[model samples]
Target: MSTPPESRQEAIARLSRSASDLEARTTRQLSHEAAGQKAAGQAWKIIADLFGGVFVGLALGFGIDYFAGTTPVGIIGGVLLGFAVSVWMAWRTAQRLMAEAKQHGEPQSVPFDDDEDQGA
Candidate 1:
């Protein structure tokens, strides 16, 4: 099928509009992906922190119990202490992130690590 050619002015206008639309769409998509990635990374960090705190607490408690000759009491107390430490860590992390966001006018990412106790 043969079709009439688009006028030059019409073609130029159409191309310009398309270019603008494409730029906008690309920008939006990139931003959305960046946000998703940041969220996923943060979520993994929280999960890791939660588990790390519990395991460390348990090990410490068990060691104490073994040295002190306490059996079941040591294990139970270790688990409870681990849970409390985990909660505290989570709270601290959240507060830090919120403060950073407030200070920078944008959300900032921090690497998770075990150095949290280095200062203390």
Candidate 2:
């Protein structure tokens, strides 16, 4: 003679299955979120490396020149090179951002298309 599912043992077994299912689902979601975060971190790391290289180059050059007592030649040349590299990096970053925005089906980015007619 078996008791109905309303009995305590049957209800407990159902609850256990549900709990396990929920745990599996939660684990999958967390792993996906972690992967996304890691990818974003990698992207930021690339950009940071570019900027950090420029910063280090300028700082080291200026510091060396200051210690060496060579006024404008070393320091200014380092600064000019760093500035040029940074500007180029910024332009590339802007272009990438614009392309990403476009990929998302976003509105037209005006500055990216200078040939567009702006009747304002």
Candidate 3:
């Protein structure tokens, strides 16, 4: 047998609850997506910094080689210097990012436990 119909007020209350739940779920999903986008943007910035460093070095080295007639040495030195600078810059950026993340109370990756590995 079918149950009795709900009252108009009960129906309205049920709809309101459903709407609230939907709103909450939508808000959570949007926030998660925004966070992912932010992370992706930061990653791209890091990659761009790395490539820009290398490109700048290469260009400077090529210019020096063209003018000074020290072809191989200039290019090689420039590339090495550029790579070193890029690495240092990347390290600094990573440190800053880590600090910001810590300050914001973001969840960090769990450190590897050697004990667990040894047991296996």
Candidate 4:
């Protein structure tokens, strides 16, 4: 037997449900894209901080070597200092990012414990 035609109310209800579902899916997709963009921005910031620190250090070191005629000594010290400063800046940025993520209720990575896996 052929099925009966859908009533007006039934059609309206179906359309409303579909709209709600579509809205929900759209919202989720948008959120995911936003999160991806945010993550990419944060990564760039970290990278800039690291590169900037090293470049500044190198420039300053070269200037010092030129003025003092110390050559390798100044350049070597400058590079070392720059690397150290860059590392510190990167570490600080990571900590701040972690704190922000925690505040936002985002999931944080936990270190895997070998002891737990051992089942002792």
lDDT of 1 by residue, 3-120 (tens): 9999999999999999998898677667767878986887788788889889988898899889999977887888888989898888888888778768868644533345534645
Q: Report the C-alpha displacement of residue 84, candidate 1, in angstroms.
A: 1.7
Could you estimate the TM-score for every candidate? 0.64, 0.53, 0.81, 0.78
Residue 6 of candidate 4: its Cα lDDT? 100
In candidate 4, what are the lDDT values of residues 1-120, reduced to their tens digit? 999999999999999999998898677667777877999999999999888888888898999999999999888888889988998999999999999988889554433457435755
Q: What are the lDDT figures for the candidates, one per model?
A: 0.81, 0.71, 0.83, 0.86
lDDT digits (tens) for residues 1-120 of candidate 2: 895559888889999999998898677667667867965876785577567757766786788788998867776777677767766776787677668767868443223233423532
Per-residue lDDT of candidate 3, residues 55-119 (tens digit) = 88888899999999999988888888888888888888889889999898956443345743675
Model 1 CA lDDT for position 93: 84
What local lDDT score does residue 3 receive in model 1, on the 0 to 100 scale? 92
Clashes of each: 0, 0, 0, 0
Candidates in order: C-alpha RMSD to true structure: 13.6, 13.7, 8.3, 8.8
Once fitted onto the true fold, the runs of candidate 4 whose alpha carbons sit more than 4 angstroms away are 106-120
